[model samples]
Target: MSAIASSTRVLVIGGGPAGATASTLLARNGFDVTLIEKEIFPRYHIGETLLVSVQPIINLLGAREKADAMQFQKKAGVLWQWGGEEWTFDWTKLNCDFTSSFHVKRERFDEMLLRHAQSQGVKVHEGVSISEIHFKGDRPVSADWHEEGSGEAGRIEFDYLIDTSGRAGIMANKYLKSRRFLKAFQNVAVWAYWKGGKRPETGFEGPLTLVSVPDGWIWYIPIEEDVHSVGLVCHSEAFKESKTKESVEELYQRNLAASPLIADLLKPADKVSAMYVERDYSYSSDRLAGPGYFLSGDAGCFIDPLLSSGVHLAMHSGTMAAACLASVMRGEVSEERATRFYHKCYRAHFVRWAVMVSTFYDVNNKKETAFWRAQTLSKEDLQGAEWTDLKPAFSTLMSGLIDMRDAQDSDLLSQTKSRLDTVLQQIRDNHPAPNDRFYRNGEEKFDWGRRPENAIDGLYCTYEPKLGLVDTGPTERAFAAVESSPAAE
Candidate 1:
């Protein structure tokens, strides 16, 4: 072996949740890993929510105790506002089996993950950016990078490269095609942390609520004790005619004024930092792995943050990528096989999420104006075609074929049929009408009927009959196409 090959190690780019998780997992598996990140420790990031699946991974890395002790808030599920009414449901109602999840401050949560990685023998360096990459043989031979604060240049060769750089340095950018949404969400988020806001008790029965408006929605995520991650996601059309170039703070206040709930919450709270805005909520990248390198988290793809799924998907993908790469490094599998594993894992994860995003805009009722109408009903608004291929890939994951991505693939017709039957059965078992109350609130209030079921369930079927079912055939075909496609292992 060449001297360069002897010195070669695993190089991980980006130090966020995905990079840190992947690096730590690899190191624990006994690989020599080096994680280089562009930002310094404890930087601010938008996604402060975590899913129940996160706990096991944290426990695996021996950071669960530390994470539990950190200043954070636990969430039961998400509460949504629709049709001028509010409803709350448990996230545990979904397929995953966790009683609750947590909201965390990124500063402490990220530091905890990185420290765990470092303690596991992973070498970590911050404030470094990759300038170029050289691929020789079947793997990356070297990468040239510079330290951020000092601007010092250096290079390193690695046996394998893992890119978890989130959206900044898309490792798959060269292979990325322009993925347009059928109906663009065209919403921007203005977010900042505050010391005082509503926080649900740890292991409570309610979700952090989202107050939905005609033009957009507001998310209230509670982080460490007494600190809430608050933000507004509003439609782009609303800002088109506005002539003022207001500061972020002004815009936030204006948005708050537009909503009574937000106005009430912000009335006494003080902003801790300058308000920041992020537009373009949706995008997709199909080819997430090439040759010896693999992509995870936002580096692979991202969907709308409406579900607060960013951090959950990132951490999950990082774990799967690390496992697949480690399999190859251990001679347990061929590199070609590993590549296939990576593609399957990444696709299975993102495709269902993409479809759910599509479904959100498709709703016609409770929607006011052309923006909301166009987003849901029109097929022309669909932006990215590469994601269409994801439909089948998503189905496979839902069928229990893959666990990397949490997607379900049943067709609307099949789901409705299943739900109808399930609802009837549940009614029989419970001795109550499947649902009790049906009403719509708007400029005028309309009452449809009465029952015990939640209002949202009256229009949409509950969990047993709604969106989360796994299909068998279409899913396999999707997986086969992805596996047989040039993009696969």
Candidate 2:
């Protein structure tokens, strides 16, 4: 075994956000960290929109300034169109500094992360591929990988193994074999970048919008230099249905034409990149960590990118993993305790986001097409998820509550319970339900008034499964109690 006598040697596989963020935090905290990436930086990636929840992570990593330096557009919140009404989820309503985040260019954003991790003393390598991992009883002991083209190979022993290889899941998939895909979020996305689109004129200049179309929804994001990130998420069956008739590009065009609102918006724009399509993308692993191994970021779970939860979760998990492992190394907590805490923290967020995203797929566009039905969940699905007795509408979830790292922050828990109660009451009272963020399109100006309430509760939010609502309030209090306890045991 290559285990050291003094310090913990951590090998983080994958150089994306998760691996980069984890390795960076670990290295900063004095752990010997090595990060390997098969692909070099300045790479292309999707999931361009970001949520406010990621601000803390970005600030923690000291990347907020770097991001600001890059001049990516500042995203205030999300504006979405469902059925025929358009509304916005303003982050400012949360009354926090992170009310604003960025819509980044993935190539630049990723390279910055890896470089920052390197600056923090992580031995980061690019163009390297992992060949094998030797483990003993779920605990990885060593790993082997080779550099690109040189054929030069190296083996490193580790006290811990972290897989942040994104959807590839690297060690989590090949060695552990514990991946599980949620049927509700099985989706396919086809997207491309556009130049010269009808850019937002003023207050809404940099926000992201989700427009519901016939068989899928379109993501219209504003990027730098008059460029826009436009993509469509089609129901898996709808995608296949289109695929059987024409080429992917042709299918996309057919849908694009059908999307007159988006088409009119993009009329003056030019395609800057070829259309790219990815299918069957959302999934999660059985458990985050066991023994001496851990899963971070996309390796742990990837929710549907509808609310731009991808980067936020990756950053949160990576940072949380670092904090948990740091506690173990510092003797503040036992390894078993750390593992349990990590599992609880990681799984709770993933499962919570999974359940929340599933609710969105129950698209209330009044259309029963394959894209809508296949992407949606019925009352049975909601009952199966058991959202809660209060059924809090699960709206603010996309606003970033589930990603908090301190599992036991009493103030956070209290705030969460209070917010859930308030939201639940709003749903029941039907008191305008805070449509202050709604912006009607096809109009001469932005509509600052409250829009009509479009609650998806009976259909997907509060299905009465065999058991009544799970009553997440108690569970929330339980976590709060554990956190506030002196021993936290």
Candidate 3:
């Protein structure tokens, strides 16, 4: 391992995808990383669908082959039936190299990532909980921990902390007290697993099927050839009103009955799991990073599941947090700069999704329904907001492009427009004779040669010599290669 100061130790809370990704990358970069989880392996989890972007992070961890070996259902894109409109988002239609993701059993998938972190030299302790975090003024210095069963207690001191504590955010909720729930997305989700649901006949083999109902929407995800995960999302008020009259199972069944598409798909299927309900799942923290800690994954923020972006945000934020800390430890960037970059970049990603999701809710044809109207973003909601107009942001997000520009830029909107123009020019330059059918029918394939861009604040992520941020200047790009075993043994 490279000679990182022996005193510098990193603690990662929660062994889920975010914690595992951050811990694995930091350990591979020669940092002393210890990860603690409140639960053991193969625990049940939701948000099983993934985006194409996750494949690159998996490659950076050198776990592509291992992920492939899991044999999760490959997800090509999503099929949407909104109100009376029918459309699809096929990944292959985009100008990107990676064109597919997966529909995983999250229990198995999360365990694989956690085990991968251990193999990469991350000290992991499962069935352990962080009871308290000891801080020196504004910076966290140590934490009090207790094992689940035996009740053994101990204190662990660390130089830096990465909080991937999913939803049970120790720092954000306990210390920082900065989490803020979005009223527009105050919704409830009830889901169950089924066997033998019919696959979509119109889209790719494993596309996520989304159908909008009068009150909310439904998601049909294929987990295995015969097993599927089905869920319903509705406004919280509607859910509460319905609960006053019927059981949760009855409410779910009534909503499912309202969707003709879902009813037909599950006509011959058997419900195989008990109903699971999650309330008000959309939230964001006023802060994502602080004096000596960074909040990653659900610890920092969580958006609605409309786009299946939960895992994508978790893994992406975890990687970004690890890179920020790695750069700080290597003396490649100041702690302040790294913290600012992480907070801005991660929050921008979250906000973009939030805006897009709210806009998507507005597009549902059931505007006449109280449930749908309550979820829609009104003009007053967008007044003076960072993203006032949702059209360009929606297009940019749908294109799957990463914008690393500083969120505080005075001309951010103009810069974003220019960036989108540049992307289109690159696409045209690469494909001089682009297929018209690709635009009209979403059937053609092309490459976008999408590469990471330097943030306006002079930092960008690189994966060649190591996985971390480096100065945009040429002098600091020559990163030293630390000797270590491949992330996947």
lDDT of 3 by residue, 185-212 (tens): 8889999999988898765658888888
**Of the candidates numbered 2 and 3, which has the greater TM-score value?**
3
Best by lDDT: 3
Clashing pairs in 3: 95-448
Better of 1 and 2 by lDDT: 2
Please report, in order, the local distance difference test score of every candidate based on alpha carbons: 0.59, 0.66, 0.74
Better of 1 and 3 by TM-score: 3
Off by over 4 Å in 2: 1-8, 200-202, 363-365, 377-489
Best-fitting candidate, scored by TM-score = 3
Question: What does the lDDT read for residue 268 in candidate 1?
Answer: 68
Please report how far candidate 3 places residue 472 from its true position, in Å.
3.1
